[model samples]
Target chain A: MILKSLIFINGFALFIGFLILFLDKVISRYGTVTITLNSEKEFKAEGGKSLLRVLFENKYFIPSACGGKGTCGYCKLVVSEGGGEALPTESLVLTPKEIRQGYRMSCQLKVRSDMAIYIPPEYLEIKEYTGEIVSTELVTSDIREIKIKLVEPESISFKPGQYVQIRFDVDGDFDYRAYSVASHPDTQGEIEINVKLIPEGLGSTYLHALRPGDTVYFSGPYGDFFLNTDSKRKIVCCAGGVGLAPLKAIARYWLTHASNREIEFYFGSRTTKDLYDHSMFEEMAGKSPNFKYFPALSDEDPEWDGERGFIHTIIDRHLEGGYKAEAYLCGPPIMIDAVTDVLLSKGVPQERILYDKF
Target chain B: MNLALILFASIITSNIALTYFLGMCPFVSISKNIRVASGMGIAVTIVMTVTASANWLILNKVLIPMGLQYLQFLVFIITIATLVQIIEIFLDRFSPALYHAFGIFLPLITVNCAILGVSLFAMLRVYTFWQTVAFAFGSGIGWFLAIIAIGGLRKKLMFADPPENFGAAGITAILAGIMALAFIGFTGIASL
Candidate 1:
């Protein structure tokens, strides 16, 4: 009985496995589809894999913040032909205009047969860089600032405020997380990013655990959150928590290069210690004659007497007199919403008030 | 069990989700959206019927006579996993539209404890072949009803103001509890 059962289980498992293999060979087979990319590149891929996985395996750096999960909607590609109709899930992420233009979330869309997908020229320019952790310091109680020096394909040129998707776990499967470049844009071989440790974020935990000399792999230069150099109005910048990263990049570039003296930076924190690198702004202020820094504390603080309320309240109080300024706000949703209302009420045009929610 | 009684009991009193809470992962996660939740419900129902019947065959034909019933868990899982893969491939070939609609959920259905639980229950009762089929079919429909009900509730929950402690996942969990409690009212009506 034991011998018969052992054979039964093993034989049944084998039969089922073979059945699955045979069906795949017959009905399910699409005979390895060819993937045409941007009218320039061509690659052959198995029919059933997601377009996002196919593109990733082919080393095309299409940024997906959610790691091929459909939620992020970052890995969008235009399928000119051969890809099927918009899936119900794909429609959730894409706008009507985008759908009409053949835009679909690559992660959710499967490549069944011969297909042509368009990767934006900008995405094609994004490349993976290997770097060593040159410097790391605790900028605040929770936020750590780290600098990376590129090893191969030495230097990178990304516009200020653009981010890079850093990947780790060299020995095993890699995990990726996006971090905005905080270092100056003109820096030759090095880049810096500020990371605030969340309660238990995998990305933040991995980044915070890194020490000097650790090798890191990252792809750049992603995001549309760079400085609009053509706007000549007064720049009103607001930053809360680690949302200061891209703003710092924009500030550093504007301070060094631009001739405008109309830059105002408002750093918001609940109390004194929550303000990461407070003195760094003061030092920058000392360097420039026209630059002003307003560090606002929201909750009750025995040490700080200046700017008692939230950043928006301070803006509301100070903006009694008319001033035409373009606002750049980056912070939590509450701060962004409140500050946006304040800025809009003070006559900052809706288009002129740009923000990145943390 | 009488066919009508099994159908009624499985759907209300002995609901796979509300009574057993066997597939809470998908129930709590996928119940967030009504459309996807219904889609998941239908897919799970079909997969459960297929897997349960297949597992019954394995239980009676392979495990019982050989005294290898101890391997129920492993064998059941093998049957489920293989069936899901085969269904996925078959659907991909013939019903491309249905494949896309239900394909993602096929892999998820393999892990659903409800599918395995129903199979085990059918075996424990020493059900005859047709009786086992009826029980599996009933269980699948029961799961579908429970999930779709929860999905409908959660659809309304999207607009409802959640409590302070109820983060998105927390809200779904609390709803699951409430749904289970509501399902208890049916126990007095049907003795399964």
Candidate 2:
């Protein structure tokens, strides 16, 4: 009797599934969608798919951190025609200028009919690069410094603080997760990112399980979280844990020009062992008079000589005449919020403080 | 019962929110603005009416014959979810304006109690097919009327100075109570 009952239940489920599929075939089937790209190229995509999914399938990947979940506003395209009105979710991300210019979130854009779209030229250049892991070092207990040398393209160049989206194949579907480029910009054939393992994070788990010399597919440097070269304000950088990656690149990138401007770097860790590298910053500061390094430890540690307590609190005692200082902060939200609160308290305008929180 | 009386009874006399109190979720949450409230109301009414008749068919033709009457809740929900999905895809492909107008609310209808409630009520009351259709349509319109009315009142309430205790939800709840009392008068007009 139990066996019969189980069989009946399975049969019912299968019948419902098949029934739904048959109905979908009759009702929701659209043959094809023609998409015009940049007014120069055109391609036909399978109809009844989101524009983001179709574009990625065709190898024209617009950067989407949320994997077409419509949370991140990265995958935006200007639809010249055949694209419907802005989705409610798109309003959270698109500026008034972008909205007027007919920008729509590609993830939310369902390709029902032929569409003419304008994609940024930079995004058009975004391509997947195959590389071999040159080295993977335990920079800290939780952090790994992954250096990948491109085998195909041989090189990648990016602004000091921009990030790259590494495509990870998890559960048979590729998810693109963004990471800031940690290595110096001068490194032509290689790029490094400091990845701290996030608890149960698919991307971090995949990155952490990699062996040296394994082939890696990390795509181009994306994101506008770069240093403003035009700004003459004193650059004050605050970092926590693996957040030091982008700030290191920005600080070193600024060192080449020297700008004759003061650049103070504040790196905070739980203890001395959690810190990635202090000697590199110290060596750079020794040579550059305008450069300064302040490494702070939040927890107690023996035989350590540096500023103690939270990095924000440490910077609180030192920030003076900060009217000309533009703070660049990168870290976890706790540190970002603490540093931002401290910075704001010291009369730093909200616009002058820029940060990337993980 | 006649169709016009059912319609009128649903819209005024026996409002789903104000009378049966079936769809209070959308009534309270989406009843802030008149435009959104009307959109939500229309969407709910359409969903409720469609789901009710469809559930009636399933309950009679599928469950009753098979002696699987105990599976009413599960099957009913599956039918409602499937129907909502079909409506969404249809709207997306053919009616972009309506799809955009519905936005998140169309997808949200799957979880709404009002759609499921109409199906349950139809099953419980043991109405015939035609009667079931009328009740479903009436119930939907009644829900629409209640939400839109509340929506308009709430918008005006925004400009009015209510007591300190009447913040968004408190004021809306108090108003709902008064409206429910008014709807009690409609009970004398129609006996659905």
DockQ of 1: 0.46
In the range A1-358, model 1's lDDT, one tens digit per residue, is 6777678778978898899888888876567999898888899988777888777667788877666668768888999988778887888889999999999899888778899989989898888899999989997888999999999779999987788888866356666777889999999599999998987787888889999999988988888777778877778888888889988998888878874647888888888888887888889888886677888998899988778778888888776322578778888889999999988888888888878765
Compared with the true structure, what per-residue lDDT tens digits does model 2 show for residues B1-192? 677776677677877788777777778889988898888878888888888898899889977887777778877888888788878767866787998898889889899987888788778878788878888888888888788788888889868989987778889999999988988876888766
TM-score, one value per model: 0.72, 0.88
Writing each residue's lDDT as its tens digit, candidate 2 over A1-358 gives 5564456456766776787778777767678879999898999998888898888788786877666788778888899988878877788888888999899999988888899999898887877788888888887888999998888788888888888878788778787788889877888688888889889987888888888889888777777678888878889999998989999889878878654888988999999889778888898889888888889899999968778999999889888767779898998888999999999988888998988876
Per-model DockQ:
0.46, 0.42
Model 1 per-residue lDDT at A229: 83
Query: Can you list the residue pairs that collide in candidate 2?
Result: none
- Candidate 1 runs further than 4 Å off: A1-32, A46-49, A287-289, A320-323, B1-45, B66-96, B103-192
